[model samples]
Target: MRLDDLPLPDTPAARAALEVARRFHSPAFVNHGVRSYLWAAAAARSEGLAVDDELLFVSAALHDLGLEPAFDSHTLPFEEAGGLVAWVFAAGAGWTEERRDRAAAIIVAHMADAVDPAVDAEGYLLEIATALDISGRNPEAWDAEFRAEVLEAYPRLDLVGEFTGCIVDQAERKPGSTAAAAVAAGLPARLAANPLQL
Candidate 1:
């Protein structure tokens, strides 16, 4: 699906999520998420992952929303992105505490290379987001040099099953079985869905 084809929220919560995302994301990253989501949806459809287009679109759009205030520069390799933009965005989207927190975990734990276990629902989405992020060019406002420097911080990633599952779960109407399980069962699907041709 194209960016215009991706789901746009009619609800206040989803709208808020978009507003929150616009603050920190460069147009390129934002565009990448749309393309990635479309690819991810296609992968899920082919794999029988049973995820919906809206959930997939919304989740992908907000996946990186958790970048911290410090995200402005590449001084820090990665920040606690899980909660950075997620907390506020989820709230705008009117997600449940459980759901919002689960979303937050993805933002905070997004740094795949830095994460100890490096396998969880949130981390899984982050991995896909990051891969797709650097794969394309970012907007000038984001600073090309800073984006490249930050991209270098992430080394070869070792994906966990649980992380990938989160994408599946979120795409599904079930919205992932308690965040923890998202990565557990969704990794293979997530890895398969990655459109970077990795």
Candidate 2:
């Protein structure tokens, strides 16, 4: 799917999520959030997965919020902390309790090695999208032209350096967290090797 063809939701909740991301994140992170959603939506279109666009967009926007000082958790992993933040945001947006839970679930699930699309399509898409954005995993899945469009719309900026510092800090603080696992698995090398670097 073309980047333009995947319409970004125009709902109040969607706008609010973008606002929150911009307020809390650096330009690199804000762009990462938006790009993650676009990549996921594009993949969903190609795979014929039925997804809630609002849910995916909101999840993508706030997935890394826990990395920010304002919302960073002392005890919980970053993703878990971010999930709680999403839950509260959904409540303020007047989403149902079930929907709020699902949003939070999607945020947390993005840290998983893999999420089954049949069970939680939004979560699965977010996982795949973030991996693509962060580590350049499966970049070839998206055509070159669409990738260029996405980068043009939301440039990568300094995501590699910014993300590395946040993730490394998370790994040091929470030794058992997914961030730690990723660090141990050579995330720095992967980030350096990411083909999306511009």
Candidate 3:
């Protein structure tokens, strides 16, 4: 798989979602979001998953929106808050009610331990893609050349330091959150040891 081989959805909703990611997230996060879409599309190709490109792209672009201060929730986990944001965005994009629910579900499932592709292909793809981006989990899942291309194009910047702080803050503030469990299970160390080498 190569960078050019990956599908980049160019729908109005997809473009607007990417713009929202750029407007709200830091550059590192924006890059991560974009990279996540590429990775997901690559995985879909490899696994023969027939995902809706526009839906996957939109979900990927806004998956981390709750981490932004403007959308951060005091009582809910970041993923949940981000899902609400996506739900609203989907409505504004003129998606059907069911489609809006699917978008929100995909955003929330990215933080889940796993998602069944048979049930939700988009969610499954987003989960694996985000895991790859954040922790370099299963780098073998993607072509090495493609991985290098994404890194070269996006540049990791200070993602490790920045994301570590974000998750840590979420953990401290919401002890029952998935972020808290991840932190308790040595997420920081895992992030530091990520094999991406970017």
Candidate 4:
């Protein structure tokens, strides 16, 4: 489905999160964020899972906030920093403490190897969505037409190259970081394993 045609939550909190993410992240990261949400939402629907749209939208929109130079923290891994940023944004948007925490948790867990849907539905969906975008896992889950439309709406802008570079930079700058671990575990191999044909 086209990005424009996809259903996005129109709540005030969702809008605020998107604005903050767009303001902080680069164009490429912003597109990645949006695609993450679209893919996650579609996956959720396919699985017949009930999702909190506002939480999912906020979590997905701000998932990469740490990649933004303004928010990048030398002390924390990008995932953790992004989660903190999302938590703060959600709190400021008048989200309840529980909701804010949930959003933060979802962002923090996106980097995990697996997210158990029974434990955290939003996180599981986000994980799958990001996996699909970054690693092309379950490419069959999204048909050719849907993939084509998403790409047409939000051109890649060399996402694999740019994102890989970002992760490598993080690894070099913060050896103790999750990005560093990913690099140590063979990021190049992972990227090759999940090639984006487009």
* Total backbone collisions for each predicted model: 20, 0, 0, 0
Query: Model 2 lDDT vs. the true structure?
Result: 0.95
Top candidate (lDDT): 2
Where does candidate 4 clash, by residue pair?
Answer: none
For model 1, the run of ten residues with the poorest summed lDDT: 70-79
TM-score sort, best first: 2, 3, 4, 1
Please give each candidate's TM-score: 0.47, 0.98, 0.98, 0.91
Worst 10 residues of 4 by lDDT: 189-198
When sorted by lDDT, best at the front, the candidate numbers are 2, 3, 4, 1
Off by over 4 Å in 2: none
The best candidate by TM-score is 2
| lDDT of each candidate versus the true structure | 0.44, 0.95, 0.92, 0.84
Residue range 151-177, candidate 3, lDDT tens digits? 999887888988999999999999999
Query: Model 1 off-target regions past 4 Å?
Result: 1-10, 52-56, 65-79, 108-110, 113-126, 129-198
Q: Which whole-number lDDT from 0 to 100 does residue 116 have in model 2?
A: 97
Candidate 4: list runs displaced more than 4 Å.
Answer: 1-5, 189-197
Over the stretch 20-120, how does candidate 4's per-residue lDDT look in tens digits? 87788777777888889988988888798999988998899999888778889989999999999888988899888998899889998899989899999
Candidate 2, 73-167: lDDT as tens digits: 98999999999999999999999999999999999999999999999999999999999999889999998999999999999998999999999
